[model samples]
Target: MSQHRKIYLASKSPRRRELLRQVGIDFEVLLLRDAPPRGPEVTEIVLPGELPEAYVARVTQEKAQAAWDAVLARRLFTLPVLAADTTVVIAQEILGKPANRDEAISMLSKLAGNTHQVLTSIAIKYQHQLLQCTQKSEVTFAPLSDSQIAAYCDSAEPYDKAGGYGIQGMAARFISHINGSYSGIMGLPLYETTDLLARLDPH
Candidate 1:
């Protein structure tokens, strides 16, 4: 695909927008919402006994499909729709976005002094083709004090991010290191995403 080709981003995540801009990919934000009866549902609920990898991939595909449905329903301009999902996993337990301050603190506490996997799945849909890929990054967090966790949680940055933290935000100080794509941990993997788009228009 041409790097300049405009696509639709089916997410409101600023991180994703920033990453796309960094790579010089032009895209428009395509927000998803239920359209009453028969509308596409984009719930984050994990299926029973779903593994972390499978969970992220499934959600990303669903999000891309829903975005396409919305575009068709609204008769919007036809463009390739991109969607992604991210999740943090530790000891095989998937930690989604925290619901409250306490949950954020709990998640941070568990993450302190430990290594966790950040799984990100990116999907794109155009015409009759759907392409997808999953990226995994291992993040190691330094030992954090109770005071530190509380202060970070109080910043209100953990509420909307997976694993109760954003690697590009204040939580950067907590991450000792990462073994995979940094952008993936931030919610989008630039390398994988670009590659997938390239596949969509292989010249």
Candidate 2:
């Protein structure tokens, strides 16, 4: 097996890209333009009765598999593919990316003065082998006023993030504390990710 100095990132998220670059990992963003278009089945739709951890891991694995197929189709370098997914859960109910400002406001309203679980599942695949893991974080929010929620909804960040918030963004003011990996809340768990790479590398 050939060792890969650079891996293929299967996400377009700038946060994930920055996280990898910040750690000095050389990676190329896999462009779906050349890959076969995906259907809604490949999307992050939570299944009925699916727990947060299960949902996140399933989504990450799905993404990694799709990216691997794309890499083969594009005949790109024989590099491993990395993919990840993050979601928020409160009272066992998943709160995904809000569709509109109204929904963002609603999600934030429910999260005020509440603690929720943030799960980020990551997957890396090379040939027939696949390595996967999940990072779970508990984030507590300060009591928020309606005005604060509305003000945040007006901004453009919430729509693209799960639980209608980003821990590393302006939403940091809303978070009182986090009990687990901070990077995991941002969508990728840096420690777990680096560890996976080190273990997967055949050097």
Candidate 3:
């Protein structure tokens, strides 16, 4: 593999880092406190009349642009910068990170014994060019009992996850089936991301 190019990951997600590492993609994490804050507005937290796909895509773009700006301002690495945002949707309802244990339980209950969509949007910026893509995965959950929900919520895994659960964590027992990219649901779509990067930086 050609190692002349550098890649900057504009995210603090360890899961994303692990995913990239699994594919042997050499990259460095970009940590800039100056990056734009993730607010309810930018995330579009299930507005009264908003679409789920559009909402997630918008947030992904916002995050990518913000990271790009930060990298440019700091004169960081000259290679491409990657950013992504993931959301869980059930019956058109976007379930983001819960604010408290009660809310986490409520979100888990809503997803119990049902099929939901996990949408992940990825954006890549290099020089003046930008590329964005959204990948969707359908995941089926087994009927979750109250005790199970409580136990999962009490764990530290669900606090920072978008759907109040992590597929690779304690919640894996609750997942019956998945019909799309597992890596995408985890936060980054490796196939699409690698394909795009190959096109941009073919060695």
Candidate 4:
């Protein structure tokens, strides 16, 4: 069998690294110091009342393109670069990383005893070719008391996670059920990500 293609991951998320390792893909971290400032694209389609799926896909694509540009500018490794973005949605509202403890608690309160969708979009870019995919998972949470929310917020786990919870961390107890890819909910969808890489490698 041929060797798998060397790859690069353009992210700082530990969860993404763990997921990629779980699939046995040989890769290196692609860190870009001058990467374009990350943010939502300002477009007519991203205005208020826009669909979450479309918005997230656009964001991921933008991130991938930005990383690709950075790689070219810096003369980094010439390999497939992967980038992704994950967001949590509840009743049409997108819940991104919490800015502060109070915001995290508020997000958790809204998610309590309710089902929300987690959307993760991944992009792979090599040379001039690009491929993108998205995975959505529905997660239901148990009713959380104020104390539970406060404790979790104080633990430093929710501060960096979307939806104010880390499914694989201390917040696992709060999840009652999940209706889709667990890995996707964690930040990176393993199957989809690996499949995309396979297409690029074809070995």
lDDT of 2 at 113: 97
Clashes of each: 0, 0, 0, 0
Q: Residues 95-162, candidate 2, lDDT per residue (tens digit)?
A: 99999999999999989999999999999988887899999999999999999999999999899999
Residue pairs whose backbone atoms clash in candidate 2 = none
C-alpha lDDT (0 to 100) for residue 51 of candidate 3: 87
Better of 2 and 4 by TM-score: 2
Q: Tens-digit lDDT track for model 3 on 84-188?
A: 889999998899988899989999999999999999998887777788889999999999899999999998888899989999888999999999999999999
Question: TM per model?
Answer: 0.95, 0.93, 0.90, 0.90
Please list all clashing residue pairs in model 1, or write none if there are none: none
How many pairs of residues collide in model 1? 0
Candidate 2: worst-modelled 10 consecutive residues by lDDT: 32-41
Best by lDDT: 1
Per-residue CA lDDT of model 4 for 4-61, tens digit only, reads 4567888778999998889777778876453347633222135576688988888778
Model 1 segments more than 4 A misplaced: 34-40
Better of 1 and 2 by lDDT: 1
lDDT of each: 0.93, 0.89, 0.84, 0.84
Error of 1 at 167 (Å): 0.7
